[model samples]
Target: MLKRLLLLLCLTGHVFAKEPPDVECLVVHLKYVHCSWNKQGTPEVNYTFYGWFVIIRDSADVSECPSYLSENNINTGCNQPCGSRFNSFYTRLVHENQSSKEKEHELKTKVKLNPPTNLTVHYGSDSNLWLSWTQISSNCVESEVRYRINNRNWAVVSIGKQNYCLNLPSHSSLYELQVRSRIGYACGLSEFWSDWTEPVVWGSNNSTDPNKMNSSMSVWTPVLSVVGAFILIVLVMMLLHNERWVICDSQTSHTCCSFLKDWFKFPEGLKEGLNYNERPCPVREYCHVRQSDSESSDCSTCSVTTDQTDCSVFIPVNESDLPTPCSSSISQF
Candidate 1:
């Protein structure tokens, strides 16, 4: 009678639960069951939560779901035992706000998470076989593996944990295997299983490849070598360019760097014209002919060969033959 009254109180309090908790429940890839709830608009000082999960299987109240809790006894989620063969689950979230009665909300639909990936069946040894997979999240704790012999109905394989190997197959045979994992939340265990990983077939003769370890290294070796060679070439070119910038471009007239600076210098033709001719000019111009200091306006010309670049030229002139001073004019052609 007390149990019946408690059940009635629990149900009657659902409307007063005040903003029913958003609830969700799912079976993950036939691995495990998960459920969670959120109490909306409830204050912490007034917030005390109580949750009850009714795990329904095959139209029967099979068991109560396990509550996942936090370090502070706060509700995280819930997990329920489920194996390869699974169908559905129902979840109810409860809240208490200063009252003996509780607020409850039940999810109308089932929720599921993504399954494990890269299911591979490898030959562990002549006598054993290995099954491997990747977890979807760190919350994932373990996998529920289901397998079959030939065309037989599936049965759960007992492996201790999901992330690591537990036990090898008792003996090698033609087998089909599939696996799925469940999450362990900071608050509690996930009450749902992710979808199953893709099935893998382990042939009796299949063996783990000995050279698989070397494959990754072999691929990286050539790539690294090429990258190293490219870097070396770039460094050499950079050094050469820096040397060009310092040597010819330096303002200091250091003798040591002069030859190299000029050798590496860009051709003068790139900026301005260059005169390569070394031959002397065939003509000359002379002006202001005068004899001695006493003869103020006398001059005579003498024929002489001189270097074309010469700045000063000397000529011997007779005083009497010199020409009288006159207004200036350009030298005659």
Candidate 2:
């Protein structure tokens, strides 16, 4: 009886002598997992005796008992009990795997952008529209942005540095512009589009009636040309009229008279009186003779004798050579 009791006490002592399983510390590194054993036993005994472990599973939630076991051998004293050992290790493994999966999911997810602000549109001289806006954030860069005009095709633009400008087509049609920014690789995340910029309508001033300007220009051109031609004709006529009456007053009147006399032939009598060679004839009815004071005339056919000369014969003389004549007349036979 004493031997049996002693054997039972030794068996109980041996069973309880195994140290309790510890909670494992699983460390996550950049690309790998590092796990350490933390047990209630002495450091020297625990360090080399327990092996680090890991388990990969698909499911997010599962009971701790059925999941998996450590590939490394851990000496849990000589008894090697099963249930008490696995709880801490299993909990930590499940937690570490969940954490790693969550981190990977987050990395794969894309970023997003806020809506654009202070949007404006302007018309350029080339009949094109220019669209501009302020940056949504400071992290915008590269060809990560794209746009659409009026829900048409998407046009990519470089957003590596922020800010964007869009050139619109040449037309007066109203357009609805939509802009989106890429948040992650391959446009993983995008932003809500901005409202249309007042529906910019483009076209020429006379787009509705294109022919009106051409007609107006044509009419005015002919009218102006006719007016100019008329003015030129009038100026030429005036110049010609003035040239016809141009006379030099500084010339003598005698020269004018002489020119007129040469231009037109006069009657024979008028020509004879103006000629220098014609002698005065006494028989002519309209003839006059002049005598000098120092001279005397002697006539036999008529009873006329005086200091003045009788009109028996006449000679042509200049008016300067004539003396003062006495008042008398002779009767015709």
Stretch of 10 with least lDDT, candidate 2: 100-109
Q: Compared with the true structure, what per-residue lDDT tens digits does model 2 show for residues 209-311? A: 5487578788899999888866765664466358753332223434543453464443455444333332222332222334542345332222343332244
* CA-lDDT, candidates in order: 0.51, 0.40
Residue pairs clashing in model 2 are: 141-159, 141-160, 142-159, 142-160, 172-202
How does model 1 score by TM-score? 0.28
- Model 1 lDDT-worst window of ten: 270-279
What lDDT, from 0 to 1, does candidate 1 have? 0.51
Error of 1 at 315 (Å): 99
